[model samples]
Target: MTSSAPRRTVLAAALAAAAGAATPSAQAADAARTSEASAPAATPQAAARRSKSLVDYHSWTTTTDWHKGRAQGTGITHGARPGIHIVHPVGTLDYKDPHTGRTTTWDYAVWTSPAHSLKVPATEVIASWNAHTPPATWIAVELRGTYSDGGHTPWYVMGRWTAGDGASDIRRTSVDDQKDGRSSVSTDTFAIDAPAGGLRLTSYQLRLTLHRKPGTPLTPTVWRVGAMGSDLPDRFEVPASRPGQVGRELVVPRYSQEIHKGQYPEYDNGGEAWCSPTSSQMIIEYWGRKPTQQQLSWVNPDYADPQVCHAARHTFDYQYEGCGNWPFNAAYAATYRDLQGIVTRLTSLTDLEHLIHAGLPVITSQSFLKTELDGAGYGTAGHLMTVIGFTKNGDIVANDPASPDNAAVRRIYKRRQFENIWLRTKRYDAKGQVKSGSGGVCYLYFPAKPAPTQHRVLAELGIH
Candidate 1:
């Protein structure tokens, strides 16, 4: 019950819970389906041990040492600026296995420079990256000799994650660089956002402390690979001496005009749901800086799941800090009952027979989907979305990430077609409607903070 390593012990107990947890898979078959069963709390320790059994356990490392990859091809060109570059390959590193060896593969991307850039003293700087999802954690990135680290550190931490299906979660910090003598190759996995179809828009960092080390001197790498499995053009046309270099978030729901739109320095979404990152990108542009391509995406593990309708109230609270507890839907709930977030989740959604009490807004999806299905009249299988908010008229207003036009729509349920589409999931409300407005559920996401409509983000890129 009491942990020797408070955080570690806490992590261990959480992990134990994850090992025994299970989540209902929604469209688990669909590549883009967001619906997922919330797994229990996972101890990265156990998952790491079990990963060997679940995955083919491929290692992409080439050296059993702490040797950096050679600078090849065209390193990111910063107009005239420069910086450092760090790469993490995919797959398992069997340091636990006696003869398994280590693996660290290079990003399929080539760079003409390092992973850092120099920002002029006291002057705001601009840092940008390209590619698909970057690493779950990064070791080090250099910018103009000044170093900014990511992942987890002794004091500051990025986050933690569970690797692979059924694999234990790892308590990893992005900035921690603890490489024991032995080494293994990294086997990088590519997400849809990579050099392929679809886009989840990852790779955070545009704000200060934005993380990284300055390479060489008086130089900034304009373009570099910021993604995990792929490459992106880290080009910057601005300079540090020029007077502008900070970005802000957006006030309205907007879309980037291109794959290379400029993004904000800090793309944090804690204020709101997935909108934080999106607004950050927009903020940077509206702040006077030319909008470059940036990455951003929203995740709803369950949208069309019949077993799990809306985001379980327990989940949002548990993950309000971070959804790292997922994979094992209900892990850590019992392990640490006193924790604030934990306590919140436990009481949010209690079942009272037919009515499933929701903590977050639970709108009628079955009804809405049915309406869309009937309106389209003849289409393929329909799906569900999130009910974010409501209009002044008490009309249910929500957002369905799948439907571009899913914003604040009222004319969905027109006929029996509306009723039929929702029937597919069987998650209908007590009255058999897609979204019933009876539960006292917190809307999924609300505007966190207001931005200055007239404010502009100005950035400066100093070459040292």
Candidate 2:
């Protein structure tokens, strides 16, 4: 769902690889093991240092965070959860929604964050936000970055999003064909045109434009706006880590994408391509938030797990033509009352273990060949699954949606193999060519009011 190409096709064309990238083999695995054994023990400080160099995450979440940003026509709402809302009309614009093909006038206001320097000069950046958009309101998130060479990137639209799919709501989408000679946006991610040539985004600022029907009191309240910047090293394999949370597993719900196949073709050609939303739905429900029966009344009665169908429709990205827009799925989970979500990258399975031990199941993204992951039974260019827990032997316990039924969704995968596929930047495809890996991409959905331990852990991981 991340690309326009079919899921089974080789992803190397979309995610270009560096020259002379090595193929994955037994020798690569052995080398990774030797490197891990020869390395010093990873203390908390050492892990943080390593993670900071690979990925940097920044967000504006507090009242103080909102006040620091320059607001044209927006005001800060301070309370238990501080946010920004439209206060006065700054301007108006006419937007012809491509999906709806209707021109509508909307009152708009803008809030621009102060420039933030990334800890890691990044080769890629993906922005995410949490907001409550009423029936007639939606938000557009854009980012402008300064390159390492002192040049600037034009403002690129990260996403046009809303929580509703009502008649008046604009179809949530990611913009296409947005690129300069030095950089370009692929769906929700902003990528340097050629990172191997030493190009990196050093600093960036985000612009949040809140839109609503003209002359109405309705306004969208934005609680969080952030981006994950990463410069993961180009490697086909990464050092394996020993599991710390063996024999512990969170009981996450199981849902299969295959069961919902051909259910809603308009949303990414049916459930065959709904790995993101399907995996998202499992975690959303695991957190005890689900669509009410009334909310799901639109679904067909004949379909099993109507909520799965509901998720596919809600998370569809019209421009990308897929349901896998990272921020879109996060925003959709936030729509539920007292829930919040964000898209971020975890450094390793140790990070996943921390969340799982706190009773939080993580949704992860990765791509691999049929032979790469044991017991997977299939390969994918890109797919998402819920990592529920670790096995007694330190393997991964995942509720993979690419199964024949809900009961078959739970599978055990080798820890080393899964970690490499998830964390590596480069990987080999079925054709023995280099392709991109997800570099530990994941979605964290939890209660807006988290438990004390949950809050502490999330804060430690820089989520607040």
Question: Scored by CA lDDT, what does every candidate get?
Answer: 0.20, 0.83
lDDT of 2 by residue, 172-212 (tens): 98887788888888788888877777888999999999999
What TM-score would you give candidate 2 relative to the actual structure? 0.91
TM-score (C-alpha, index-matched) for candidate 1: 0.22
Error (Å) of candidate 1 at residue 241 is 59
lDDT of residue 312 for candidate 2: 84
lDDT per residue for candidate 1 within 88-167, as digits (tens), equals 22222322211123232222222222222221111111122211112231222222212122221111122221111111
Tell me the spans in candidate 2 whose CA falls farther than 4 Å from its real position.
1-17, 20-52
